[model samples]
Target chain A: MDHNWDFASVLANKTLLLIGLKNTLVLGSVCLALGLFFGLFVGAARFSGKSWLYYPATAFVELFRNTPVLVQIMWFFFAFPIIAPFKIDAFTAATLGLTLNTVAFSSEIYRAGLQSIHKGQWEAGKALGMSYWQQMRRVVLPQAVRRMLPAFMNRAVELFKMTSLASVIAYGELMYQAKVVSTISFNPIEMYTSVALIFFLVLFPATILVRRFEARDTFRR
Target chain B: MTEVLRIEGLHKSFAELEVLKGIDLSVNKGETVVLLGASGSGKSTLLRCVNFMEIPTSGRIHLEGKAIGSARNGRVAYAERELTQLRSRVGMVFQHFNLFPHMTALENVMEGPRTVLKCDSSECRRRGEKYLDKVGLGWKADAYPSQLSGGQQQRIAIARALAMEPEIMLFDEATSALDPELVGEVLETMKELAEEGMTMLIVTHELGFAYTVADKVLFLSEGSILEQGTPAEVLTYPRQDATKNFLRGHNMFRLPEPQID
Candidate 1:
């Protein structure tokens, strides 16, 4: 069957798509910021020589990394309400699920950056009488940050794409809104086509930004 | 005068191999002691043990008559906090010049003062600039380690160590990694330091620099000091077989003519 496409139906409901698109971007960015913040601590603790800090951090990273995001989202959406001290809506559950997943991957990236530093750097810090944490904060981590930037940008893109999985929990993000539009319009192909267009519009510039940041730090690296 | 540094029965072993035997040495105040040896002769190992960098298997090290790593119930005991303070007093320069790549030359010099000493920025920066100029790197203070040449980096490393105002400086083949031409500039700075009465222990193969600068010369062989004396006594005279052989290898075994009245 030769199909004649109509985007006007999707455009007529542009407000719904735009709102869902905002939800997607906001959730992705919030998750990213929190994930990166928590991930650095997890990564640093994972690299800690002390057993007490290392084991718990390892468990956190492994539990999130090994499970599928869909399973996690469902678990949070259903189970977290019962387990948590207070009731949480699907929006909070989805945000938490996305953040948990991103933290696990990002923590590993941070660990990779930490280990990329040379052993002599630590010794140099010691020779200068800088304490252990001072070495990390002042010497090793500064160099590691440069090494991890490309990996971090990659994670941002990955998390943005993964936000689509929030649809499973009936979260009002881009994918969930698209399903609503398609069901009502009864034109799955056209509605989904516009959804794809909106996603591309948001992510393309983001990818370009990552590339520019990488190029700027090329000589420094 | 009391010795500024003393090592007694210092022994270091890695697995089955003993890298440094029961070594004994002493460095008096304002003296520059030079260590000469072939590769694997333990000159570097002996120097490292001074600041407990290598953690000698068994030894007693004293700085100005104060024993490092206090003995507790016949066992050597060290508190890490105290050790860090002690190490800062003993500055070191490496052959590869391990400068912090992200920091400028001035920043590298100021790091010790700022972080360890907790000096204010104004004091640290002023002292850093003074040391940079001391090393003839005043114009290059803002340059990163990668931006500088090998010799310049090594000098910056020296200036970094000097900023700590260490009581004794250890140079582990400081000029070995420099270009032949660049070597002179670093050696000149070190010579000036020695002349200014900075007690130093140097492990190097630069015979000319050693001949010109050593207050005492020690020849190490097979993890032990084989010969040691004034440079005139050790370098220009026939001594042990190991010392003679090492000098002969460098084609420098000729002793001065005997004086006749």
Candidate 2:
């Protein structure tokens, strides 16, 4: 059987893909921001030395990181409605699932970064008369952020790819729109290729930006 | 002269080893004291205990006659914050020259005054510049630690410590990390400070420099003070066998002629 490439069919779904692309951007941006906030809390708490603060945060990170994201999306979509009386939409569920996953991974990244800092840094801060909080904020966090640069970016890339799984929750993002167009037009190659291109467009610059940041930091050193 | 620093019944241990066994040291105001010791003699550990950088196993340390950084007579007199506040009065310069890598030389000097002392920006900057110049690093104000020589970095570290305007300063092998050719510059800077009446306790192997600048020279061996006296007395007329042995072993003191056999 000869394969006929349908350029027009792919082009016709541009509007759908544009809307999907917009949704994907919104989802990734929100998840990244909220994930960082939650992740910082989790990461800082894990090292806070208080058992009560660390243990529950550790459990949350482990539960999210160990399980599959598809199951998490399903739990949020199908199971959360059962446990809670509030009716939630697919996008909300997808956003929540993605945010939780990002938090788990980012917290681990932060913990490793924080641990890599020389104990001397803390001592130097303390010796300079900095309070414990000041030591962590002014001295520890800046050094840790620099040390975690590569890992932080890699996690963002991972989160970007993971957004593809949001399709399972019927979030109407890029992957879901790609599936709909390919099924209707029967042009899997063209539609999927276009989908891959859209992803590259969204993720490629972020990777470059993160790399630039790493480069600038290294150069500073 | 009144005492600026006094340590009594100071002891420190790690696991099975006792590093400092009841070290009692005192430095009068405006006096320069040099601690001489071989490797693993616990001179550095003694300095750490002075600033509460390493919590002593048990001890009493007084700074300017005030019970600070450690306890006295069974009561916990200083909390962590108060101990930190006390540390601001006693600056320390390390052998490795622990300047923050991200900060400029001037910024490193300014950090203590700005962050700890809460000095206004103009005053901090002015004092930073003066100290940097005093240490002969006036031109390297904007350079990072990586850009400076080992000696230059140590000088910057000294400047950073001095910017705190501390009443007492501790030098833990300050010039030990520098090139032999570069060591003289830092020692000269420190000697000048000593002449200016800066109370200092220096742990060093530079016996000649120690002899020239220190009012009192202390020889530590096996985690205890083996000998201490004026430099002429300690270097020229050592009374202890251990001091004589250490000097001879390190080629610091000339050995007597061996009988021809």
Best by lDDT: 1
User: Per-prediction TM-score, please?
Assistant: 0.90, 0.92
lDDT string, candidate 2, B50-82, tens digits: 888888887788888987654467744557877
Clashing pairs in 2: none
Query: How close to the true structure is residue B102 of candidate 2, measured as C-alpha lDDT?
Result: 69
lDDT of 2 by residue, A1-221 (tens): 58876778889889998988888878888888889889988988887779998999899999999999888988999999888889989888988898999898898888888888788777776777788888787777877888887787878787778788889878888898889888998888998889898789878998998888777754165
For model 1, state the Cα shift of residue B143 in Å: 1.5
Instruction: Locate the minimum summed-lDDT window of 10 residues in model 2 chain B.
Output: B69-78
Distance from true location, Cα of B3 in model 1, Å: 2.5
CA-based DockQ, model 2 = 0.58
Error of model 2, residue B15, in angstroms:
3.9
In candidate 1, stretches whose alpha carbon ends up further than 4 angstroms from where it belongs are A49-63, A78-88, A217-221, B252-261
